[model samples]
Target: MRVAVVVMETSHHRDTEGRRHIERLAATLNEAGHEVSVFCAQWWGGNASRFEPDEVTYRGVTVEPAETSFCTRLPALLAKYRPDVVHAFPTPSSVLRAANAGAKLARAPLVVEWFGDHEESVSARAIGTANQFVTPSELVQTELWEAGADSDLTTVIPESIDMDLVRDVVPAEEVDVVYAHPLDDSANIESLFLGLAELRQKGWSATVIGDGPERDTYERAAADLRIDDRVDFVGSCDRERRLAIYKGAQVFVQTAWREHFATELLWALACGCIAVVEYQAESSAHELVEHRDRAFRVTTPQEIADSIVASADMDRRTVDESLAEYDHAAVVEQYEALYERLVDEYGLF
Candidate 1:
C-alpha cells in the first residue's frame, strides 16, 4: 500500500507530540514494506524538492513553512503521487481542506489524525473533510466526536513502542520509584514531590526523566520540600535508557495535568513498573490502568505515597507480555488494516 502523509510541519520543523506521532507512524509503515511519502513544508537546506532522510521520503510542498503556498501546491503533488490513501493532520484546519481536495483529485481515501492538542474550532470545521479519523486515545476520540467527527468514522489507535527493547535492555540500577515527563507547569511534579515528602522516612529513591524550561523550578521544589537528596533529576534520557530505568523501578508515578496519551506511562507499564497515576480531568493516563492489576488511580499526595509503599509488595518484573498488543509491529498492522478496509470500501484496488 502507498500512503501520502500531508502535514504543514514536522517534528524537525518544530518538535511536538503530534508531529512526532505522525513521523513515527510514517516510518513504521515504510518499515513494514509499504511505500510512504510525507508532503510538508521543506525544513531541509538547498533547493531540492525531495529529500529521503531515513526509510521515508519527504517531499517539500513549499520551500518554507508558508501556509498559503503549502495549501495551494499540496493538492497537485498529492494527486501526482497517486497514493492509495491520503493521511493528513488537523492542526491549521486549512491544510485538511487542501488535503481533501488532493484526495478527491487523486481518488484516494482521506484519513485525518486528530491528536487532541489543536484548536477544537478548527477540528470542528475540518472533521467532515476526511473519510476517517484516527486519535491516540478515547479521550481524543470523544473530543473529535464533540468536534463534529462521526463516531462511526473515528477510531482510537494508541501510540506504539519498541517492545523488543523493553524485553531485551538490561535493567538500570534499581530505584524505588520513577517519574517521567518534560518538567513544565503541566508536569505537576510538585504532586510527586509532596507525596515523596510525606514519605521522607521511607527508604525510597526516585529518578525524574526529562528536561524543559521548568527544570530549575522543579528542582527547587524538591529542595523546598527537602527531598532533593533522594530524587535524582536526570534530564532528557533516550528511550533505551528510560526503558532500563522503568525496568528497574518498582513504581511509575504519573502526575501530569494533561496527556493526549500517557506514552511514557505506557512504556513504564510495559517495562513492568507498577502504575500510580494521579487523576486529572484532561489527562488520559488513567485509561491505561482501568481494571488492570498492579495499577492504582489516586487524587492526593497521601494516596500517591500509599500506592508507592504498596508497590513494594507486588511482584517484580522486567517486562510484561500482556502489553505486546501495543508493539510497533502490532500498531502498524492496525494502520495497514484500516487502510486496506478504506481502500476496499472505495474500490480503489
Candidate 2:
C-alpha cells in the first residue's frame, strides 16, 4: 500500500516528541512492507524558511517538503502520491486540520494517531472522515470517545521500543538510584528531589541524568534542600552513554505528572533499574505500570521516599526478574501487531 504520512515541519536540532514518533511510525509501516511517503511543510523555527533538500527518501518515506498550508499543503501532495491510506499524527490544532484536509483530498482511508488530547478540539473541525483512531494507551482512547469518536473505531496500539539499542547495556551494579529528566513540578520532580534528598541524608547517592528548562533551578533546589552534595547532575546523555549509567542504578525513578506511554521508564527497566513511578489515578502512567507488583507506584513524595528506602534493600534477583517484562523484543512485537492491524484495515496493497 502506498501510504503518505504528513507532518507540519521538521527540525533536526530539537527532535521533538512528534518528530521522533512520526519517524518511528513511518519506519514501522515500511517494516510492515508498505510503500510509505512523508509529505511535510517546511517551517524552520526561529529562522526564515530555506529550501535545500525538499525531497528526502529515507526510512521508506519519500519526504516532500513544501511551504504549503492546510488548504494546499497536504491536499496537493496527496493528489500526487494518491496513497491507499493517509495517516496523520498531528501535534497541534492547526497542523491536524491541515492533515485532515489532506486526507480528504486523497480520498483514502484515514487514521489519526494520538498521544494525548487531540480529538477533543479537532473532531468538530474534521467534518466527517471515516478515520480510525490509534493510541498507545487507554487514556487517549477515552479522550477520543469524549471528543465524539466512535469507541469501536478506536484501537490501542502500544508503542514500539528498539531493544537492540539497549542490548549492550552494562546494567547498573551497586548504584542506589537513578532519575532521568530535569527537576520540575509537573513530573513531580520536586517530589523526586525531596525523596532523593531524604535518602541522601540517610547516606544514599543518586545520579540525575538529563537536562531541561529547570536545570539551574533544580540544581539550586538540591542545594537549598542540602542534598546537592549527594546528587550528581550528569546533564543530558545519549542512549549509549545512558546504558552505561543504567548499569549501576539499583532503582529507576520517573515522576512525570502525566504520560501517554512513559517510554523512558521502560528504557530504564530495560537497563535494569527497578522502576518506580508516581502518577495520578487518571494518568496514562498508571496504565503503563499496571502490573505494579513488577514496579511500585506512589502518590506522595513521602510514599516515594519510603518505597525507595524499603525497596533499596530488595532482593537483587527479584528486581532483575521484575524488569524482564520490558525486554525490547517483547515490546516491539506489540507494535508489530498494531502495524499489521492498520495495514489490514487499509488493505495496504
Candidate 3:
C-alpha cells in the first residue's frame, strides 16, 4: 500500500518522546512493505537533516512539513504527493489535518492514530475526512469515546519499540532506577522527585535520562527533596545507550501525568526492569498493567516506594515474556491487516 503518515515533528527535529514514537511507526510501516511518506511539522532548529523548504527525506520516507496548522497549508500538500492510505498522528490536529489533506489529494482511506489525549478535540470535519480511528490502548480509546467520538470509533493498538536495542545487556546493579524522558510538564517530574525522596530514605540511586526545558525544575526538586546527591540526569541518549541504561537498572519508572502507549516502558520491560508506573484511571499505563503482570502501578509517593521495594523480588524471565506481546512485527501485522480492511471496505486505491 502507498501510505502517507501525518505527524507533528520528530526526534530528527527535537528530543521528544512523541516525535520518536512517530518515527518508529513510520520506520516500521516502511519495513512492512508499504510505500510510505510522512507529512510533519518543521522543527525550527535542533539539527534536523537539512532538506528543502517544504519537503525532505529523513530515515527512509519523504517527510513534508506544513508551515501552519491544517487550515492553510494542507491543500498545497495534497496537490503534491498523493498517497493510497493516510496514517495520521499527534492526536486530533494531525489526524484532522490529514483527513482534509487526503480528501483533496487521494482517493484513499484514512486511519486516525492517536498517541494520547493531545488530540482531545476532533471536529466533524476531521472525523468526516477519515473512516478509521486508532489509539495506542483501550484507555486511550475510552478517552476518545469520552471526547464525543461515535461509539466504536477507535481500535486499541499496542505501541511497538525496537526490541533489538533492548536485548542482551547486563542490567547495571548500581543503577536502581532509570528515568528516561524529557523532564517536562506532562511528565510530572515532581511526583517522581517526591517518590525518589521516599526511595532515597531507603538508600536508592537513580539515573535520569533525557533532557528538556524542565530539567532545572527536576534539578531543584531533587535538591529540595534532599535526593539531589542520589540522582543523575544524563542528557539525551541514543537507542542502544538508552536501552543499555534500562538493562542496567533494577527498576524503570515513569511518572508521566498522561500516556497512550509508552514505548520506553516496553523497552524497560524487555530489559527486565520491574516497571513502576504512576497511576491515573484514564491512562494506558494502567491498561498495560492489566495486559501484563510484570508492571506495577501506584499514584502516591508511598505507593511508588512500596511498589519499588516489592518489585526487587520479581522474576526477570517473566518480565521478558510480558514485553513479548508488543514486538514491532506483531503490531505491524495488525496495522497491515487494518490497512487492507480499510482499503477493501472503502474502495481506496
Q: Point out the higher-scoring one by TM-score: 1 or 3.
A: 1
lDDT of each: 0.92, 0.64, 0.68
lDDT of 2 by residue, 229-322 (tens): 8788888888777777775777787787666676767666666567678876555766666775647888788878987887777654312444
Tens-digit lDDT track of model 1 for 103-219: 999999999988887643575657778899999998889877777878899999999998998999999999999999998889999999999999998788999999999999999
lDDT winner, 2 or 3 = 3
Q: Which ranges of candidate 1 are over 4 A from the true structure?
A: 119-123
CA deviation > 4 Å runs, candidate 2: 11-15, 43-70, 91-107, 117-120, 182-185, 317-349
For residues 151-173, write the lDDT of model 3, one tens digit per residue.
55578778886665456554454
lDDT, residue 294, model 1: 84
Range of the 10 consecutive residues with the lowest summed lDDT in candidate 1:
118-127
The estimated TM-scores of all candidates read: 0.97, 0.80, 0.79
**Model 2 CA lDDT for position 110:** 70
Please give the TM-score that candidate 3 achieves against the real structure.
0.79
Candidate 2 TM-score versus the reference: 0.80
* Window of ten residues with lowest summed lDDT in model 3: 53-62
How many Å off is the CA of 302 in candidate 3? 1.4
Count of residue pairs whose backbone atoms collide, per candidate = 0, 8, 4
